[model samples]
Structures are given as structure tokens and as C-alpha cells.
Target: MKVTKDIGVWTGTWLLLWSTLAYIDFFGIGGISLDTYFFILSFIVVFITCYLIAKAFYRTPLQKTNIVNYKFIKILFVIVTCIYIPILYKSLVLMTNGNIWEYRAKAFGSNDEASILFGNQNLRILYTIFIEGGVYFIQFAFLSLYLLTGKKSYLFKGFVLIFVMSIVMLGRSPIYYYALLVIFTIIYRSNGKLSLKVPILASILACVLFFLSAYRAGGEITLSYFIDKYIVGYHLYGFSLFEKSGGANSFFATSSWFGQATLGSFSYLLLYPFSKILSINFLYFNSQEYLLKNSFIVLNNGDEANAFYTIFYDMYQDFSWGAPLIYGSIFGIVYGIVYKKAMLRKDLNSFMLMLFFLNVTFGMIFRNPLATNGFVGFFFYFLLYILFNKIMKKRLHV
Candidate 1:
């Protein structure tokens, strides 16, 4: 049986992922560009090299599941979903003012929620667990339960949770996750086999939810905002600025990126949502600061730069010309290890971790996502999965 996660990993890595660099940086303005060539060539080279290397390390992915524990996951995800629904409602209805997007733009974007967010340490932790913590895991959990257990209630509740969560939070990133969910749900329905109507209906419903989310965010929806803010918002225009303003060349002089790897530039940013809870000091490392300073997009438009600390940017900051190859090979080896392990265990939890890894890798193209609360939340859940597996093996002796 196919792992189902392969879809996200492949597309997230090679197919539709890294083109944003070229799309915004050079091609946005005019003629054939050298930077465009570099970005594309690097992407192709890295993708092929990584895939081939990972292929070498692959030892038959997880084929079929023998153990049955759908009941456990069903209760787990459903409980979390139920807990989250009310918190989400309270956060929206009582916490935020005015429209959803406006409140988000003010709280997260402007960072004005610090007082409310950081008022009490215990509440902060509780809020984190309630909001970004369990909620993130439940997204995957709901789908897994639905697919594995054949429960339409789980499916309906999962989709509704996703839709309402995105609407109340005013976030658009969940669109990708929903698409991935549809793919996985279809694939797993037949126990990793594919059919037409299941996937198709899943996709149609996802789109419906997406549009409903957009509508709920504000009564306004425009192609330009969607394309520009979400799509173009992730462009690599900062590279052009780096090229135009004479190469900084300072990266080669130091091993700063090594430090960044251990604690990424935005790792603190990842913990920001939990700052009130954890009492960790986090500095603002806005991606736009570099964009407005260098890239023509910000230079001309003068809009707040929503820069994507693009993969190349982080790699370049760490290793100038060798960024792609270095990072590419590293991720290839890591991906290979996970693929091999998932193949060996053939468990749903391990498979979900693989999916999470793929999502992080793909998002790395646009932002340093590995260090975010989203990724951190997944890490803890993966740990819990490992512990749960141990407990089950020890007690149930299955």
C-alpha cells in the first residue's frame, strides 16, 4: 500500500514548491533574468539529488497495517476537537474585536496582544495547549481517525473544525493542510488504495470550506489579495536585493548558520505564541525588514514587507553559493531515514510524522517553519505517539 504521505512530500519538495523564488524575485518585473535561472537550476538540482539519495536509502515503505487501534485515536482526536471548539469560539467572540482578519492583523501582526497573552503564566500555558498545541495535532488526528475507522462524524467534525479554526484565526495556511487531508483521507479509505469519488468529493468539500473561510475572514475576497498576499507574499524578492546591493559575502566568514540550525533565526518566533506561557524572551525578526530594505517589491510598493526568509536566504545566510546543495543533501538524508523507519514500522503515527516533516520541508522554501510552534507541537505529539506505542506494547502485549 502507498504511504499516502508521498503526495505531500513529493509535491511539497519538488513540484510546486520552490518556484516562488523565481516567480517574485526577477520574473515579476521584466525580461529573462540570471537570478531566475539560478533559482530554478538550484531547485531542480536539489530536488533530483535529494530524491535520488532518498531513493537509495528507502527500504520498502510501510505496506499494510496489522494492528488495530482506531478506537484509541478516535477518542483522542474527538476529545481534543471538542475542547478546541469552545476555546476557538471564546477566542473569537469574546477575545477579538471587530472583524476576524482585522483582529489577527492587530494582535499577531502588530504584536499588541502581549499584555493579554502574557498576563498569567499558568493561563498562558493552558492557552497554548488549548490553542496552537492540541489543535494542531487534532487536525491530523481527526483525519486519521476518519480514514482508519470509517467514521463520517469524524470526517464532518474534522472538516468543520478546520473551517472554523481558520476562519476564527484568520489564517489561510490551513488550505494546504486541508488539501493534504483530502488526499490522505481518500488514499487511506481503501487502506492506501485510490478511488475517484472519495478523493474528488473530499477536494470539492475542501474548496467549499476554503471559500467559506475567506468569506468569514471578511466579506471581501479578491484575486489580487489572494494571489498577492498569500502567493506573492511568499516570493523571494529579497534575493534580487541581495544581488543588486552587492553580495553581503559575510556568511562565508562565520559559522552563524550553525548556531541558527541549533536554534533557527525564527525559533524564538515559533515560541512567540507560547511566550506568555513559557516566559521566554523573543525578539521581533520580521522577514519584511530585509525585503523593504532590499527587494524592489517593498522598495516600490512601500507596503509592510511580509518577507519569507526563503530557504535560499537561510542557506545563503549560512553558506552562500553552497546553500542549496548543502541543505538539499542534509534534508535528503533526513527524509531517507524517516522514510526507511516509516517503512519498517508501518504505523499511522510514524506516517503522520513523515507527513509533518514533508510539510516543514516544503514550507522551508517560504519560511523557516521548522522552528515554529506548529512544528514544535508536532514534535511533542510525535513523542507522545512513541510513548503510547511503548505503553501499548508493554500492557496489551500485542
Candidate 2:
């Protein structure tokens, strides 16, 4: 079904509001304090850009389709397998570098490690890219094709394989798995509409489970914590007083809290550049010095390591206002294009596009948008899709 004018308006307005809030929360009103106003303007620019792009692509003529063939699929599979070998080998080699893992671990804990790792003038940024990038693009390729082709069995098998691999390689982050399931469910639901009753029940269950998990995790609770920490606490809440809270009260109180908030924030930020523009400086860059110093004190005071927050804090200190908006916008545009293109394919559905969008969004939020690993993965995936279609057409004599 074609996207209606109402849907377009709704999407644009939602994106604009969310983006503005997030950008403000992240970057704060710093020196010169143009952030808030700049963010508003940026939101308008982004919305118009995206709307125009969508309209153009949707209205453009679609390329003729080619018939599929087993031989073509096999050839494409072989090519993909070959390309993966080197990527896999390089990733493994980098994994052996203890410093990378140690820094990654430290970065996870709320330290300056992530900033140090990325900030080191001599550090090979490509290595960082290779280590964290490829998984999502791989996911996009498999899912997009399955959606386009309407091959449930193939999609199911691919999901299982990718899911298992992610768990094995990335460690235990339920958010990643849960995200995949959410996207798949959304996509599978006919016409992207979940029954209101089912969604309401699911939302209730999710809230209950979240509280149960938090309670089990154990922490002091307050009104600010509930609003800032729990309410807008997800990644999208942007920079607020809750983020200003220091010590154990900071949002990154624990790994689980950090994971949940980060995922939520990342999802919205990457999808909406205006949000990133507003929040990036304050949340990720400018706040680093404080985060590192505070986290260091907390460490001395018997707090568990908050290395990841520290790394984020350090990033703010290093890059200031420039890093978040510039990087975030570029990444958002790229991913938006991918999502738009994926949607154009007859085989894919909104569900698959949502999944791909989420993965891309997360990467852009936490890591540099231009990280090598993500770039290579995305490039290969898109290239493979184009090649696969070409080979299928040639074989079928279309």
C-alpha cells in the first residue's frame, strides 16, 4: 500500500518533535547557546529532506524484475561466503588484541576507555569499525530478501542462525534479541497494524517485567528517577535533569539500565537527525569530562566500573558540539536511504525495514557513524542484493 499524505505528515511531525527534544537533552544549552534554536531549524531541514527523498523514490519508476533461479542463488551465496571469510578473519585478528577487548570492557563500565580508544590520534579507527560493524548489514541482507521473496522458511532459518551468532559473538544482551523479535513481529503482522488489544497487553506485560527486573536489580528510587530514570528514561528522553544527576543516581547506574536506556535513545536518535543534533553534544561529547572525573571518583568510592559512561563522557569533552550532530546526521541519512530502498523492494515489508533501521540506528548512536565495520557490512549487503537480482535475471533470461 502507498504511504498516505497523513502518514507522511504524522511521520514528519513525530520525527521533528522527538528529534528536537533529544538534541536539546543531549547537547544542552552550552556556550553561545544556539543549540536549541539550531536544533529546531535542523529539524525542519531534516523533515523536508526526508519527505522529498521519500516522495521522489516512491514516485520514480521501479526497475524491471528478474526471475529467480537456484544456480543464481548458489552463486550469490558463494560470493557472500567468500567475502565473509576475510572480514571474519580480520575481525578475529583484531579480537586477539587484548587492548581492544580491555578497552571495550572498560568503556562498557563507564570509564574514559572508549574515548581513549577512539581519541588516540594514532589508533586505527578501521579496527574499531571492523570489530563492531558487520552484524546488522548481514541481518538486513537476509531479512530484506526473505521479505521480498515471501519465503517464510528461509527467513526463519536465517533469523535463527543470525540470532545464535549474535549471542555467541556479542555476548548476552537481551536488547538485541528482543529488538529483532519486536521488528519481526511488527513486520509479520498484516499491514503493520498490531491488534490494539494485543499491543496493549504486551505493553502492560513489558512494563511489569521492566519493574520486576529493576526491583530485582535493586536501587534507590525517587520521583526524579521515576520520571527521568524510568519514564523518559529510554534513550529518547534526551538530556534532562535526570542525566544531570551524578553518583549512583545517573542513568548508567548498572549495566542493564545502561543497556535499556542506550538502546531506546539510539533507536530514536539515529532515525531522526534533529534529535541527534540536539542531544549529541551534551549527552555524548560535552559531558565527558564530568563523567570521567565523576566516574573515577565513584570507582574510588566503591562504585562498580562505569567505563562506558565515562567513554561517552570523554567523547563529549573531546569533540564538543561538532561530533554528535555532523556524524549523527550523516549516519541518519544513510540509514534512512537504506530503509527507503529496502521498502521499495517488492519482497520486503515494513517489519524488515524497521529491523534494519534499528540496527543501523544503534550503531550510529554508540559508535562513530562512519565506522569501518558498519560501512563494509552495509556496502557488501547492498552490493550482494544488487548482484543477486542481476544474476537471477540473467539466469532466467528476463
lDDT of 2 at 231: 37
lDDT of 2 at 142: 52
lDDT of 2 by residue, 1-398 (tens): 32221223433454455445654544232111234335334534554566456545543234433335334444545554464566455444544554444534433233334433234422333333333333444445455555555565554444443443332233322234334344444344344544463456456535543553343234345545554433343333222212332312232233222221233333333444654767644333223333442342222112232222311222233333332344334434544554455455443333344555554434322222222234554544445556776776686786
> Pairing residues by index, what is the TM-score of model 1?
0.70
lDDT of each prediction vs. the true structure?
Answer: 0.53, 0.40
Instruction: Give the per-residue lDDT of model 1 (tens digit) for 147-173.
Output: 456776766666676666565555655
Poorest 10 consecutive residues of model 2 by lDDT? Answer: 296-305
For candidate 2, the C-alpha RMSD (Å) to the true structure equals: 11.7
Off by over 4 Å in 2: 1-41, 53-59, 64-135, 149-155, 169-189, 196-358, 362-372, 388-392, 395-398
| Error at 6, model 1, angstroms | 4.2
Best by lDDT: 1
Candidate No. with top TM-score: 1
Note the residue pairs that clash in candidate 1. 62-343
